[model samples]
Target: MNDKENDSLPVSALQHFIFCPRQCTLIHIEQEWSENVLTARGRLEHDRADSGYREFRRGKRQISGLYIQSEKLKIHGRIDVLELEEINPKGQSNLPSFHLKGTWRVYPVEFKHGQPKENDCDRVQLCAQVLCIEEMLGVEIKQASLFYRRIRRREDVLINQELKDLTRNAIKNLHALFQNRTTPPPINDKRCRACSLKDICMPKRMSVKSVKYRQSLFQPQEPL
Candidate 1:
């Protein structure tokens, strides 16, 4: 995709893409959405995180709802929380290099409704945010975090090369998916049961029914 088009993609879509490409296409490409109990709780969790609040406590500066983007990755989104830990400028440590004048440890924390998953969905999302922050601030972040509402605590994530590679691959696939503009067929698996868009998506029905005919029926065509 071109730079202009890539700029329009959101970082959150990477999580969706990781979870299920069809879900990503439905929400991003088709603009379809629905609310379920799970999604509602997740929204409630994000509401507090996205409040645009800032604070300083115990030698750390906490910034909520910080907007960030990456020209290289071609994704933009708001961070749930950006915690900056003050450090000794001259002290040498294993932390990432601080590009800015001040010495600080940067941490991007993402808020989620559930506990940590086995898949890379949440981690990739967090890593994408890290990449965006790195590009925007010209700094390297060695660690990030995720706050799960279910566990009511924070989990540390190592920003390693593997996670970065996964995130970059996901971004490339996301742009390609958007360029194709074709919604993928649903898998009708356990994930479909939890998805909020299950009703609208009709995964089971669509999987069994004639997708092309349904598309032709719903879409308008020009008269010849």
Candidate 2:
């Protein structure tokens, strides 16, 4: 895909692609969506996060529902919570806005509906947010955090090379999928049960049809 197409893609697509390519395609390419329990809960969680509030605490400034974009990464989206910590400007360069006279380090915090999962989906999403912040602010973000409602705690994520690579690759893959505008077949794993698109996907029925098609490829032909 070209740069224009890539820039048009949403940052959320990375998380969806990590969770399931088919799910990503279903939502982005096919433009299909259904609100199941899990999805509804997630929506509620984001709604709370995107309340558009700003708070000041000690040496830090907390801004919620801030929109960010990165031309380098070709992604744009709204950040859940961005914390800017005041720092002494020893020899640091000035940022674009004079309001931020003192050097401020940015830290992104993403909110989740459930506990930490045994996957890199959430981590990748957080890293993508950091990338956007870095590009926009002209600074390097070394770490971020994820706040899970279930655990009521924050999980710090390091914005390292591995995660950066994974996120970039996922974005490229998703852009390619979007350019082609094709939906991938489902794998019908346990994750499918919780997916909002399960009904529309019909993984089990599709899997059966796929099996039958494969079997028919080798079936003996009837005598004429």
Top model number, lDDT: 1
Candidates in order, TM-scores: namely 0.86, 0.87
**lDDT tens string, model 1, 120-161?**
899999999999998887779999999888989898999999
Work out candidate 1's RMSD over C-alphas: 4.6
Candidate 2 structure lDDT:
0.84
**Per-residue alpha-carbon lDDT of model 2 for 1-224, expressed as tens digits?**
77565557688988998898889988877889999877788888898579998998876889899988878767888999998887865536445552666677788999998899888999988888888888877789898999998779999998899999998887778778877875677879998978989999888887856967866888998979
- Residue 110 of candidate 2: its Cα lDDT? 96
C-alpha local distance difference test of each model:
0.87, 0.84
Give Cα distance to truth, residue 29, candidate 2, Å.
Answer: 1.5
TM-score of 1: 0.86
| Model 2 lDDT at residue 175 | 72
